[model samples]
Target: MDGDYVIGGVFSFHYYMHTVKHNYTTMPEPLSCAGSINSRGLRFSRAMVFAIEQINNSTKLLPGIKLGYEIYDSCASVSVAVNVAFQLSGGLDPVFNTGDKCSQSGMVLAVVGASGSTRSISMSRIIGPFNIPQRVADVIRRSTAKVVVAFISTGDMKILLEELSRKPSPPRQWIGSESWVTDRDMLRFSFLAGAIGFGIEKSVIPGLRDFLLDLSPSKVADSPLLTMFWEEAFNCRLVKSEATDRSVCDGTEDIKTLRAHTLTHLISTSNH
Candidate 1:
């Protein structure tokens, strides 16, 4: 509030359907589970809308400036996002307008979910043809808000790093908790450095494991071996050589600076 006005924009694409199944090789296997997206998209959209509202209502970083959101139902359709971008660049029609309080005003676009490499590449390419203003284009290009936390697996992280490496400017900075990394994913940390080869200015890895463990050690401990692997991988450098709490691994100070810089860039460029 006392500083720059930050416009928090959240844009998300929806998946219309998901199918799940299980097999029992020893016994008669039955197709067990399937989830439909008819209600899923709406539910996810509502949650996102509510989150933006809550953040704007409560957060100090953007006291006067409100959180804005746009929910585009890719509806599992790549064409829709592409079309939406074209339409938004010209300005929103009355039918699409959500009113003054909403973040969907004007054509300034922010993207959220691009579930996989293919979708990400498609969406990025679709927007590439548009001649959006530099600030707006920068926001769209550099955004990583919708990163798939679950898919932060070694394979996906490798793909992301490779993509970032090819960018001309790369991102100015990246921020994430160290817990986001794992032994198998150490390449991601190194990849962040490689992104610097492409021109990323800084990378900040926050350490949130202690905070998370403090809240629910049992639940976290119950998670798969991958979780521990990632925690240990990230903690290796930060943790005390002998102790387990890994207090030494905390990277809060560095994260704060990176966050400030990221927020500043977001606020400065958002209205463009």
Candidate 2:
């Protein structure tokens, strides 16, 4: 989507950045993300896009203007989020050819969705000075308590859970904040079986289900990110199969036929 004014969004779409070893040799390669995509993060990002599109389509809201967005993946790292914040703030200049006409680029009107408390804090330090409004951290371990309570977002909670999963600890009762209490990703942890918390009441957004299901391979041909998302969700490949074992998608897969658990929140609610 493109508009007269652009907004920025940052989310922990990936759990971590691919590790790189710097030998103080040549310039390091650009950072890449690893780990399975975070569904909750994806949901938050799509909601933003959906809302923006809705506003753009309405005649009564910002009648003559359109809104665009530049979304970045934080990779669940404070450094990555801060780096993206700089880009959103126009701190990094874009390079252009001497032969090409250059003009001032569009700046983001505001930013939304940092996805985690620590990432939000780190990002605010960079964009706050510019008057950008933003919408929306860690620890644990070595303690002897039989129970643990976490008030952090799902991104931070995932990191904590990973650390705790690596070691043998007593069966501890877990208390989660609304952020992660109802997150499907958190449910994968057997240790959180007895966890208790309240999630914000879910809201219904009429036609949102159709909005998500209406995606087509041709519609997202230019975006590798969306293509990857389609592949992951449908368990098929849109691009040429690099591996002999992979299944190439036919582009006719019906999203409506997908199991309820495959995209429950995405199809049923606007909750984050």
Candidate 3:
């Protein structure tokens, strides 16, 4: 960012919801998504970076546009997405909190993100600024020409459909992605119509399976991203000071003890 560049923002759910605990002593320790990391979602996030890098290199795409981006992890949570949006817009500084949500740096031309419907909606409200964020808790309405699209799980779709029903907004067209694009239960909802989505396109990624199987403690130790993933995978904290979970990592555990998502963990280092 030393020279002229077009900055964009990327938001994706790199973590999957695992569990919520109400057993905390206080107002429930918000350990957000169990601090879990989804290997598949990690890959999706990498894809966005790759695409942006490609556009910056391409002479035909945006001939004069030297595109760069700031990526944010939404944790697949609506509330978290709002914080991200506020950060992106600089309207609410995410860093400084003095009982007043404000920040000195919030700037972005556009945002290419939000994997889920709920997240996408949350982002649009903050970005579009029809002052829609005030009603996110109880109501969500839109007054725009473009239709709202969604790419969420079946359960999330149910919540989104219910929210849309409460408002007077017209039935907006949605373009679906691979997830829940053709869900049988989704077809039952009248809110989503003409929701065309690409079905599963199978392709054998050569050498990918082998690369994943080859990962070991020795290999992961060199990578900070992998090391963090390992700790999250095992539900342990490698750093003694940052240890929030009861279980502590001795740093001798094998990487195989964590679930292997070759596609997911591979791209994490690229960002780091």
Candidate 4:
């Protein structure tokens, strides 16, 4: 009559079948990595928590059954992630609860922020120890979830695309907004095409300027690109505004002067 189940052990055929029938998919559940507060991973975690709550409240799943979750703050650190894994395996305190059940059925980890190739490799190495069971390890190693999105202007897009090309299994999709770049950036377009060759199924570029045009200046400026991209991608232009000249080149002379001064200072320091 015991409802508790201890995983990571050999199971009888009957028990295996019973658990299989009730369990979610066998994939290693996604986990989020973020700071303790004010992080994108935290927001994602909140949404997941809300969904589970709704499901349990409405009895959407098995009548009396409910979903359980455990959160670990990676602090965006691989060391923290490894430590978290150990803590979870040891039945440490959970961030959220599901009635009387204590441990989570599985883990969902998230990786946020960006890193270069070297940093990515280091992170992969840090998490390598936990990548046991060759099958699961292989999936994690080959997963595209670790890839990053770069939006630092079209010039930087070429470098990012080149890096992606070097990956064994490149991203399967590219999502961005029209404001991400100018049409003249052929390298960016070509990179999208190349990603498709490496299993990239689709590329999505959102149209956000049209939507922002109608919103108040403050609101438009405050919106995150990710949120704006989601909203304006589907031809939803809820804002209207008059066009005005707003170009970075307007202060080109000042920038040039600053650069010249910086170089002069550097040269003088070196001479001394």
Q: Which parts of model 1 are misplaced by more than 4 Å?
A: 1-37, 94-105, 115-117, 127-272
lDDT of 1 by residue, 181-210 (tens): 432344534424221112223442232212
How does residue 101 of candidate 2 score in lDDT?
Answer: 24
Q: Write the per-residue lDDT of candidate 4 for residues 160-200, one digit (tens) a residue.
A: 44555555344344443332333234443443522211212
Top model number, lDDT? 2
**What stretches of model 4 exceed 4 Å from their correct place?**
1-36, 93-272
Clash pairs, model 2 backbone: none
Task: Choose the strongest candidate by TM-score.
Answer: 2
User: Which 10-residue window of candidate 2 scores lowest in summed lDDT?
Assistant: 95-104
Q: Residue 10 in model 3: shift from native, Å?
A: 4.7
Instruction: Give the residue spans of candidate 3 off by over 4 A.
Output: 1-3, 6-33, 58-65, 91-106, 127-151, 154-198, 203-227, 233-272
- Rank by lDDT, highest first: 2, 3, 1, 4
Minimal lDDT window, size 10, model 1: 1-10
Q: Against the true structure, what is every candidate's RMSD?
A: 16.9, 5.9, 9.8, 20.4
TM-score of 3: 0.48
Q: Tens-digit lDDT track for model 3 on 134-242?
A: 4341333545544656656544665566666665355557777666675565666675546777777555544434444465656666555456666666666655664
What lDDT, from 0 to 1, does candidate 2 have? 0.71
